[model samples]
Target chain A: MTQPLPMPVTLLGYGAATLTTLSFFPQAIKTVRSGDTRGISLRMYLLFTLGITAWGIYGLLTGDGPLIVANALTLVPALVVLERKVQSLRRGDDRLW
Target chain B: MTQPLPMPVTLLGYGAATLTTLSFFPQAIKTVRSGDTRGISLRMYLLFTLGITAWGIYGLLTGDGPLIVANALTLVPALVVLERKVQSLRRGDDRLW
Candidate 1:
């Protein structure tokens, strides 16, 4: 049988999950502020967002709170960047490096 | 008491983790092939790499095999891209958008 995680491990997992999820914030903010996503790769973000969504589903099914929390938070910024990327592409903005 | 994850959920988690880790492979391969990371953000990658490391640690501590496997696979490509990013920066390659 699987044992419950120790308190320290749980804490670490939560902390790590929070940091990882928050890491996407800067990019989201940059995209929002500059209204530029020319440098961001659409394919990469699309795949990543999808992957995260799958991970979130996995988390929910497993009842892994850390995974659920992290992926849920990550989805917000990922979607934002993704939308902006698509918008920029439609606008004929070729500034994406 | 916490229950062990169902087999399907575990499978889904593993599958998601594998896909996510593999997703980074393209960027790593591209960077290696082109020897250019100019468009890649250094700070962004650095933080991401660190976050992944932390997540890996959390995974190890919690005995979350899915997290461990995913992050371990992810680290290989992440470090490669990260190293290339730093190398390009030092070489004065500004192509990173």
Candidate 2:
């Protein structure tokens, strides 16, 4: 069995992992559904995508299973969001639709 | 100097920390500038806030300096976003402006 992280730590890890990873869902859905990227900042996505990559590295270095898993999973959706945002920008249509 | 994380790991950590930490800037600026929360998600914020709190705890538990610091810093802005989102919901102005 994976040794339980210290109780407090476990709570923190789970919470942190859950929030950071899932926070993008609404934006992702809305972006896709409405095809609107106006509200999203390409700069922010660029930064976020890069940051998540770093976190993934931290996870690997520390062999922190949670960090690795969380970051890895998040990278995909976050990247999608970033890519779409970029596409939206390049298209430069005021109305994303 | 902190022992360099494995070169690759260092790259990952720095990148992750930077991206995750800074990603919110665009939203924060846009949200404030436009006073629009139509695109923001309350549920996502609530979850994100709670998750960040958890990450904070994990940082403390593991004595991981980066995690602790990063999460702590991110929490304030994230909460602000959430609060604004909540307020926006309450106002239900149909026009955030």
lDDT of residue B54 for candidate 2: 82
Estimate, for each residue in B1-97, the C-alpha lDDT of model 1 and write its tens digit. Answer: 2677788876776677766778778667766876745445566677778888988998787677877888888889879888987887777775344
The residue-by-residue lDDT of candidate 2 on B1-97, one tens digit each, is 3354567766666676767887776667766666666656666677777887887777777878887888788887787777777777788832332
Model 1 spans > 4 angstroms off: A1-4, A33-39, A95-97, B1-8, B33-39, B95-97
Q: Residue B47: error of model 2 in Å?
A: 1.3
| Clashes by residue pair, model 2 | A12-B54, A15-B51, A47-B19, A51-B15, A51-B16, A51-B19, A54-B12, A54-B16, A55-B16
The fnat of each candidate, in order, is 0.37, 0.74
**Superposed Cα deviation of residue B6, candidate 1 (Å):** 4.8
- Largest lDDT belongs to which candidate? 1
Computed on alpha carbons, the lDDT of every model, listed in order, comes to 0.75, 0.72
For model 2 the local lDDT of residue A33 reads 66
Worst 10 residues of 1 chain B by lDDT: B36-45
